[model samples]
Target: MDSGIEIKVMNPRRGDNLVHPVGVGHATSASSAPLSSTSSPLPDERGLRQQQQQEQGLRQGQQRQGLIDFKPLKKWVPWIVPGFVLANIVVFVITMFINDCPKNSVSCVAGFLGRFSFQPLKENPLLGPSSSTLETMGALEVSKVVHRHQAWRLISCIWLHAGVFHILANMLSLVFIGIGLEQEFGFVRIGLVYLIAGFGGSLMSSLFIQTGISVGASGALFGLLGSMLSELITNWTIYANKLAALLTLILIIVINLAMGILPHVDNFAHIGGFLSGFLLGFVFLIRPQFGYVSEKHVPPGYIAASRKPKHKPYQYVLWVISLILLIVGYTVGLVLLLRGVNLNDHCSWCHYMSCIPTSLWSCKSQQAYCESIQYGNQLNLTCISNGKSNIYTLSGERPSQAQQLCSNLCG
Candidate 1:
């Protein structure tokens, strides 16, 4: 046997001096395990350490993956925000291009959008009248005035604009705030914000508009601004106070607001839109934020009785009344809209400069003064000497030819 294969053996029965051959029974005496090797770890321990490192790497990779997942959320936001911006663009484009002909100019477009309404305003006919077919039918003259009130404008008025520039500015602001809110809160909520805000703005306009026609979506755009301001306020603590941004935004709003006070600018509509948007935003947005994060829950009676399944008596009545009012208003508006009031009809018979326009008369004029003209054997006569005249000459030579020209011209 080799020395490396040597082994030690002990027996209890043999005396101290007695010894046995350790290699007698076994062919190899040395063991495979080394003392140096025993001092160190075994294969299993090394494998476990490698596994722990691998797990740590995996955890780090998962953290990276989480961030990667979050980055893609922006790609999904276009559906909510961009969609509305596109829709507004489409509506305006359609409204503009569809009536580009000379007769259907901007004023004509305004009339079209107004659904041809004429009416006296409810409280102040001089302020702003309602604008809508619905509002037109609902128009009621003051008790003292027997004249039919101008048709109230609402829906179409919101879309109409004082000018192309007015439409452009309002549309631009709407895109900015609308897309922002839509991306953050999603389309459904953004749409609700837009509609409610717009209606609120319209209501404000309704209260203020006297004799001038009110138009444009700025009121609704203002509403969007209010809603966004609300979101910022509600999330200020969580979002790291965006004071600088808010201040800058406010400055921009103020400049535009000042512009509203300028000549031909509708300050009433601007103010109405702003206040309504602010109020509505407070009710729908700021209050909800507080409700969600409040340290202490609102008392049960404040919203509803804690134990009671039904709302409080006052709340129930208030809700009922609100619902009824909305229904009544909608019903009346619908009826008025279908009635198709025409503003031009009322103006057709109105006197202008005391000289009856050519439209009413079959002949030149009811009163007569003769003026003479001779061109290539044709003679023309009119009642007024220096008064304004419209003359047409056709290719002719003789009195018969001239008579034919006058007959045709007069005809």
Candidate 2:
């Protein structure tokens, strides 16, 4: 054997090292042949499977998102504020329609918008401020004044403007502040802020000025303005050069409040509104939004609560209060009717500004009782006939026929 050279032999047992085909040794098998229609799904089948998987994921996403997601109530606060502002504008428009735009605003405009508002207290009942009333037949929802921190009025006094200018001014303020705040905070915050600020302003006004019947959403608007101001002050980063916007807003509000306070201005309401707005803006506006309001000012722990549906516990409270109000309102209505209050008793309420001038309603009581009647429809008719209650027929038939029909049903 040679020490320097060693002979190497192929291993016959190794699968890769097989002998030639003609040789007796096992022939090497070719590289593994391509799988015959078994390697993977067909392109079409794969596409379909992927599409199905994508669709399932999409459905799952949609399910989590929900239909008509009321979750973003906080995000919609600014929307609510602007909507409220719009409502006030609409009210002004309605007033314009009702008053027909008198040359001297003191007459027609004053009559409708300022019919019930806080004016300077005077010995004469006619001169002093009065409550805002909703004329229902002979019933009047007169404006009621509160004194000494009558906080409840904060909610109500917002609806009480002494004049068209006041309404216009306050509404304008709301428009400016509400739109911005709502867009940032969402509907829930805007709505709550408006309501709470309105309530707070009203309460503060009443607390300070008890005897006068002050009204108008101006106070709440002022509160909103104050909140905006506070927000600018606190978050100076965002509102750095927002001075023009702030000044314009302040001037508008100042002009309105000045008009109310300087000479005949209900300064109390303005001050109250301002303070309330300032306070609420701090309470509600402060506490920096989680990750910049985080899609709705959702608090750290209470985000879930904020995302709840519209008809939550608070809605239940609203419903309960609504029921209570409805019951009380209806009860009071029945009592007044029982007390023999006729349509003529409350002229301001019996008709629109006076009385419906149409001939279709034969009985004045029908008009008088219109407010008290439940589920009132256009066709439903209940009027007075010969000093007695009468129900009209849409068929325009004789009274005797209705009587027979009623008797047939009762019998």
Every candidate's CA RMSD: 17.3, 21.0
Error of 1 at 180 (Å): 1.9
Residues 260-319 of candidate 2: C-alpha lDDT, one tens digit per residue: 533334555566567656655654554332223334434333323224332224334433
Worst ten-residue run, lDDT, model 1?
137-146
Name the lDDT value of residue 277 in candidate 2. Answer: 68
Candidate 1 has a TM-score of 0.46
Q: How accurate is candidate 1 locally (lDDT)?
A: 0.45
The true-versus-predicted C-alpha distance at residue 201 of model 1, in Å, is: 2.0
TM-score of each: 0.46, 0.39
Q: How well does candidate 2 score on lDDT at residue 34? A: 20
Please identify model 1 stretches exceeding 4 Å from their true place: 1-76, 79-152, 282-411
Give one digit per residue, the lDDT tens place, for model 1 in 122-207: 21122222222212223222210113423344444565543345556766777767766666566766666666556555544443
Supply every candidate's count of residue pairs whose N, Cα or C atoms clash at under 3 angstroms.
27, 29
Stretches > 4 Å off in candidate 2: 1-78, 86-153, 237-239, 242-260, 287-411
